[model samples]
Target: MKRPGIVLAHGKWDKPPYAIGTLADALRAAGHPVLTPELPWSLARLYDASFHDALLILDAAAQALRRQGCDRVVLGGHSMGANAAIACARRHASADGLLVLGPGHFPDWLHQQGISTDSLARAAHAVASGEQERLTLTDVFQGRPRPVRIPPAHYLEYFAADGPAVMPDNCRHLESLPLLWAVGRADAHFDLGRGYAYALAPPHPASAYHELEADHIGTPQAATALVLAWLARTFPEPA
Candidate 1:
């Protein structure tokens, strides 16, 4: 009769407040245990952040949830965090469900906009050469037109869609688990032809995808109702 716990991961350049705070609060108020662990890629030194590092954080959070009496825990994240959540769920045997919000596409939509990966490559080189611990980069995916700063090594981990943390590759791991894939219709990072299709075409019988009217950051509120309904259906409480 116990509800499944949830471990929500925040997106790149984001923390619990502007990221999973609202959703976590709502889920907790609804009686579901929730934990929004701070990802290394969030506020930590950029050079030390990597997809694998974020996965470790998720692992720790999941374990903490288990210690807190949650036998099952749903893995969820927003934006870049979604990709991390998927990667975590792929290898996590105890991940009961997956919730992907505004998931980023492989090769990214910016590639279609003619944005080259030269910057990323150069940053990687710099990191390899020990030239810099952090680098300022432009991301067409997240909000604000201003440039953002990140660690070159971490950038490669998440942005190199062809890399190990590729979203499509991760989604393919969703076979029988319950999945809720939600995205904002106005999200600049979402590529319908690629990302959306990949998520919708999952072979899992319990998988469902929704396109909401909100933007990248608005997904938490926009998909709240649907998320709750799905949770209820997927993990019903015994009478």
Candidate 2:
């Protein structure tokens, strides 16, 4: 049997490839092909691409993996990357399984926290006025305020309360596929529990939810063993 190929996306505002390096290395060392793509949310790119564009980028990366000879593909990510993974699965439904770690980035939740409301309103105004210039928007990362410059239209695509980045909504819309959602106990979003998002996803017998002892940044490394085991069990290679 062909070994499964896995594409791991890095978190928002994180440096490319490195943010998920540890987990990606583990998967590669285990004889699985891995691709760690530099997503638009990376520190260098920072909202340069719309959410849909990011999904397309992921699709390209997954296709690259298939061309590398893997029979099955798994989409996985950390933090905001995890959000993108879920949204990508909903849009493409091509991957065999999903591996989400410390899933973050919920537009509705950010609005509730008063982080994106003002910026979203401004972005809306800019969009209405036909302004094509990039606007500086406030986003929160790990409880700290992060400012990002992005075109008004693109900003709204991500920060809108009913946007595609909403985790629970994306989960709800996901196609039926095996999913492994692992969250950190010490992560800020952990308190929301699996019921907030994971439970909303279409159920599959191989789906799982794990709570780890690590914090947000540490989740990928901490869950490496669990992820490898899940992959082995869910998509075992023929002996």
Best model per lDDT:
2
Per-residue lDDT for 1-239 in model 2, tens only? 27799989999889845657899999999999988888888889888889999999888888888888878999999999899989998988758999999988888988988888899999999999999899888878877878878899988888898988898898999888999999999998888998999999999999999999999999999999999999999997787
Poorest 10 consecutive residues of model 1 by lDDT?
193-202
TM-scores for all candidates? Answer: 0.84, 0.97
Task: Report the lDDT tens digits of candidate 1 across residue range 1-239.
Answer: 28889988887667548566788888998999988877765645432666787788898898889899988789998877787888887766548888888875344544444453766677779877987566787554453433557677766776664665766666666556888888888887655634443543356666788888998888877888888889988888868
State the displacement of the C-alpha of residue 232, model 1, in Å, after optimal TM-score superposition: 0.7
Q: Best-fitting candidate, measured by TM-score?
A: 2
Off by over 4 Å in 2: none
The Cα local distance difference test for each model comes to 0.73, 0.90
Report model 2's TM-score to 2 decimal places.
0.97
